[model samples]
Target: MSTEPVLPRVRPEIAALPPYRQGRAASADGFKLSSNENPFEPLPGVVEAVRDEVALNRYPDATAGQLRAALAVRYGVTADDVLVGAGSVSLIAAFLQAAAGPGDEVVYAWRSFEAYPSLTLVAGATSVQVPNRPDGRHDLPAMAAAVTDRTRCIVLCTPNNPTGPIITRAEFEEFLAAVPADVLVILDEAYAEFVTDPEAVDGLGQRVFASHPNVVVLRTFSKAYGLAALRIGYAIGDARVLDAARATLIPLSVTAQAEHAALASLARDAEVRIRVAELVERRDRLVAGLRDAGWDVPDSQSNFVWLPTTDPAVATAFEDAGLMVRPFPDGVRISVGEATSIAPLIDVAKSTILR
Candidate 1:
């Protein structure tokens, strides 16, 4: 038999890893709270900008220069400090690629961003998961202790995914103090906009701390800016760290239309900020209502709440009620949407939990 050369098998780390399973796009009825997407449409200007940005004949700008400039202005930093990519997920993969190597350990909290371990493993790093405390927040001390001579990076997801808890500025400063300076710590702030803590440390500001030279702050236009479909995000860190991170990106990663939409969102950021305030109100209401029904719903600064569940049956109950939520092993993460969108969730909670 004539042999076409067999491609060498996949990398061991990647070959053994399980895939990232995302939430269902279609459900029987009602709203889907699974993905934590902004349940609102893009603002008119952003929508119009995206519509007009069709350029199939040309390649997108590899570095996303225009969007990075706009993000810099919006975040009060120089453009050199900013790096834009296809989505925060893409940036996460690049950061892992830049920071880690085979047999190197990358630490992050369990039940945080679901993608963390997947990307960490795919980049040839060993995943070190720090368990969440009783309140569903990262155990900072434990995470810091997980670092060793072989540790390469750490991901701190504030307003953490699934569990909507933010590490206070004081807590983060302490966490930074505990972590080894050589281990790159990525602060994933994908839901930073929905957060309203008066003393909350913007992840970008933390990247500026000389003591935490390894800190990289990650944020996305998906949640609060209402631009999930456009898939643009930015990371802020030391210029050298950013340089290394950029090297990991494939050619033309961020789309041209996404860049235009991101720029427009930055231009209309004040309006988006106002929208964030409104969503915060809705989040508060959802937490209040759920807690009143005798369920232990964590105080959520993000656009979602975590309900402590003793059984998976309770998770299925939510799905049966024409509502979709992210069911983790220990609990369900229910996203707060538009004021009206949250009504059905409240109704289901009242019917099932209260009565």
Candidate 2:
């Protein structure tokens, strides 16, 4: 008999799917801008809250009741309307799993979030990716046209990842009107705290859930709240919709430390706002500097700016200058990190663009 053991059968689609790739880590002396992370240290209160959770022997509150209640009050919703997950990405996965299955279609913008396609695939659903416009904004009309009877869900990422343009309130409203009432709409506002534009859509303020039973707004404490390490995010929508997502969630994924830290962060909301304001100022300055250097940078309402370059060499050049940025097939995304790193970044941009 052959000594080799047979491998278990695997689904072909799952086998073909590429694992999600994360941003590359930086060297000790380098600035890591590949991930759109908050450069500031965690608030003292947040740190203390995490330390206060000492029950290693006990499992965390699986429902995350305290955190959900807190977020419910903030968003003017009942606790039943909120769903907490390990992160916004996890909530997205749960939503996809809950709503989509084999032969169903999930529509979203291409070159938006890298995880969208994979999430759909994992849910045994088809992805209908509408191409982004020349300005890196979602072509909402095209997306609406793409939806069909097979479509189960639509993901709208504003201040879109990798490309920083936002969907205007008017645009989203019109798109929502065009979409069928039964189809689930996920409004991913991960970077909303950095937005300074008056015209941009605020999903929370818009009361999308109240207006449309199908709409769900996803937000994260990872970016602006500096809780990426803790991995806590929440969704606001109808109780029935959230209940479905809750069914698909990993048991006890949201830790007590994360929930307490999020609560602490909320308590010091004014201080958090100040940190966000500083980052926004830095982002604006960085965009201005790049534009002055003759780069055709987009007007980013997020914490990062996009460089519409297809050149692979640009990323290498940045790495050579001890700055790690995210390089995609269509563009490079450079986050506004430390103030000390800005001079080097600008110098590199000037040299590369001039070349």
Please report the candidate that would top lDDT against the real structure.
Answer: 2
- Local distance difference test, each candidate: 0.82, 0.92
lDDT per residue (tens digit) for residues 17-72 in model 1? 78888775535456788888887788768878877885878898988888778777
Residue-pair clashes per candidate: 0, 0
Evaluated at residue 335, the lDDT of candidate 1 is 80
**In model 1, what is the error at residue 225, expressed in angstroms?**
0.9
| Tens digits of lDDT, candidate 2, 1-355 | 9999999989998889889777777899999998999999988777877787747788999999999999889989999999999999999999999999999999999889999999999999999999999888999999999999999999999999878989999999999999999999999999999988888989898787898989999999999998899999999999999999999999999998899999999898899899999999888889989998889998898889899998999888999988999999988999889888888888899988976
Instruction: Count clashing residue pairs in model 1.
Output: 0
Candidate with the greatest TM-score versus the true structure: 2
Q: Can you tell me which runs of candidate 1 are displaced by over 4 Å? A: 1-8, 26-29, 205-211
lDDT of 2 at 116: 96
